[model samples]
Target: MKSELEKREILLESGTNEVEIIEFYLGGQSFGINVHKLREIVPYEPEAMTSLPESGPSMKGMLLLRGKTVPLVDLGSHLRKRQVENSVERKVVLVCEFNREVNSFLVDGVNQIHRISWKDVKPLDDFFTPYKPRFTGCITVDGREVMIVDLEHVITEIFPEQTIFGEGEVEGAEEADAFKRGSRQEVKILVAEDSNIIRNQIVSILKSSGYEQVTSFVNGEECWNGLNMLKAEAAHKGQDLREYADLLISDIEMPSMDGLTLCKKIKTDPVMKELTVIMFSSLINEQLAHKCQEVGADGHISKPQIHALVKMLDEYCLK
Candidate 1:
C-alpha cells in the first residue's frame, strides 16, 4: 500500500479554505495531521534509533534521516494511551515540520489521505474543557471518527523551551515593555485558538502586557458566534463592533471554521468588516501569507513569536 504521505498532493489553492489530512493509527484509534506539515513517511526501524539519555518517556530517541538527526516521538506514549507494542515490527513513522523545525512521530500504521473542509472538523471544546486533550479537533470520515493530533502542542510538551515566551525568546524586550506601559488598557481583543495551553498563555501574556479587556474562544466557529453576539449588542446600543472588540487574533488551523475563513467573513461583513484581524499560526509560510492577505487579514505572525505578536498588536491596535 502507498504510504499516507506518498499520496498525490491535493492541489488546494491559496485561500480556498480547505485542508488535506493524513490519517494514521495509534493504539487502535484513528488520528490525523495536516498534510502540509508532513515531509514524508518512513518505516520504523528500532535498530536505527539512537536512545537519548535523560529524555522524556515519549521521546523515543533520535533517527538519522537524509543526513539530519531528527527526534522521534512516540505518539501513543505521548498521548498517555496504550503503547504500540514494538514487537510488531511493521511500524510507521511520520516526518513533519512546524515552525521551521522537523520531527518524526511513530504510529501503528498509515491510512489514506482525506481532503476535508474545515467546517467538518469540530473542536473538542464543544464537548468538554481540558488543559490539553492531546487532540485539537475531531472529524468523521466514512462513518468513522478521526481525531486530529495537536502536533505543535505535543512537540512543545517535549521541548518546553520552544514555547513563545520561554527564556531569551523576547526579541525586543525594551520596546515591548514600553508599548505595554504606553498602550491603552481598555482595548478589547478577541483571541481564537484551539490549544488550551496556547490560549491560556496568550491570554496571560496579553493581560500582563496591558491588554486587560481580552476574550478568548477555542475555535473560529465559537469566535464567530461570539462576534455575532457582540455585533447584535453593538447594533442595539448604536455602537460599532470595534467599540466592543477592536481586534481579533486567530490561529489558522482551528476547527469548524479556520482563521482564514473567519477573516474573510469579518472582512466581508458590513458590521465587522472594519475590525482588525491578525492571522497568528505556525502554518504562516510565504504561500499561507498570501492566503491571509487574499482573505483580508490585516496582519500575519508566525507561531512561537510572542514578541512579534506583541509588536503587531501595538502597531495595529494600540496605534
Candidate 2:
C-alpha cells in the first residue's frame, strides 16, 4: 500500500487543467466527454444483441464485450428526445469509464478530438435554474458550442448507492497530532461536493487548520447516507445526535439531489434541524446567496477562496 505522502504526490502530479475530449453529436447539438475517461468508440452494429429491459429507457440496454456485460444508455435520449433515429454513418456507441466502472452510451455521430482548457470553459445559467440541466458549462469549438457534462454527477445520478470511499480511515494520523494540541477548538464540518478536485482541496485546508473529525461526501445522496450512519452510531453510543457533525458545507449544484434541496431536507428533518448549513460554490452573487438562504442555508461562500474558507471554518465551525 502506498503511504499517504506517496498518494498525495501522485495526485499532485496529475494537475487539474485542460481536458482532452471526444466530441459527438446528439439531438443536433454537440457534447464532449473527457478522453481520459473514454475507453473506446465502437460502431453500432445492428447484429449486436441488446439485453436492456423493455421498460428500461434511460440507457438502451446492455452489450456483451469480451466476457463483461456493459450497460448502454441512449446518449440522445439522455439529452432530449426518446426515440432516437440513427443513420448508418451516425450510429455509434461511446464506451466510457465512470467511477472506474466502464459503461457505453449510444450517440448519433462522433466528432474529432478537441483539446480545450479549463480557462475556456464557462458556466451555464440554465443549470442554475429549477429545470434539470445536464452540462456544467459550454466550450466553444471552432466557433461552435460544445457542452461539457459533469461526469461525476451523471454516474452518481445513475448509481446513488455506490460509496465514494471505503470505511477505512485516511492515513497520516500522526501528522494531525500537532492540530489537536492547538488552542483553536476543533471544527465539526460536513462537506457535500461532487467534484474531486474541490473536495480534496477543502479537506486539505481543513486538516491543515487543526480541525479534526471532518466528514465528506460527493453528492447529496452520500451526505444523507453519511448522516444516517452518524446518527445510528450516535444512538448506539447513547450520545446526542447534535453532538455529531457541527456544520454543513455543500456545493450549489450536484446529482441525486442538489445542495439547496439537501439543505432544505436537513433543516426539515426533526433530528438534524439545527445544524449550520453553508452553500460554498464558484457560482456566487447576492441573488444566489439570497436563493441559498431561501433553501435554509445559513451562509454562502465563493469558490477558490481558500482564505475565506479558512475564516468561515473558524467562525462557524470552530465556534
Give TM-scores for every candidate, taking all chains together and pairing residue i with residue i: 0.85, 0.49
Lowest-sum lDDT 10-residue window in model 2: 6-15
Deviation from native of the Cα of residue 39 in model 2, angstroms: 0.6
lDDT scores of the candidates, listed in order: 0.82, 0.65
Q: What tens digits encode model 2's per-residue C-alpha lDDT throughout 1-319? A: 1143223323321212334556888776788875544667788865574755553456577777766778777766655644334543548887776444677888788777775555566656654454223566667888898887665555445555433332222332234355442623455689998776568767765665566567889777689789888888988999877788788889865545557677877888887878888888655554446657766778887654555665666566544
Q: Model 1, 57: alpha-carbon shift in Å? A: 3.1
Question: Which residue ranges in model 2 land beyond 4 Å of their true spot?
Answer: 1-16, 82-90, 126-133, 163-319
Superposition error at 77 for model 2 (Å):
0.8
The positional error of residue 54 in candidate 1, measured at the CA in angstroms, is 3.0
Candidate 1 residue pairs that clash: none
- lDDT value for model 1: 0.82
The top-ranked prediction according to lDDT is 1
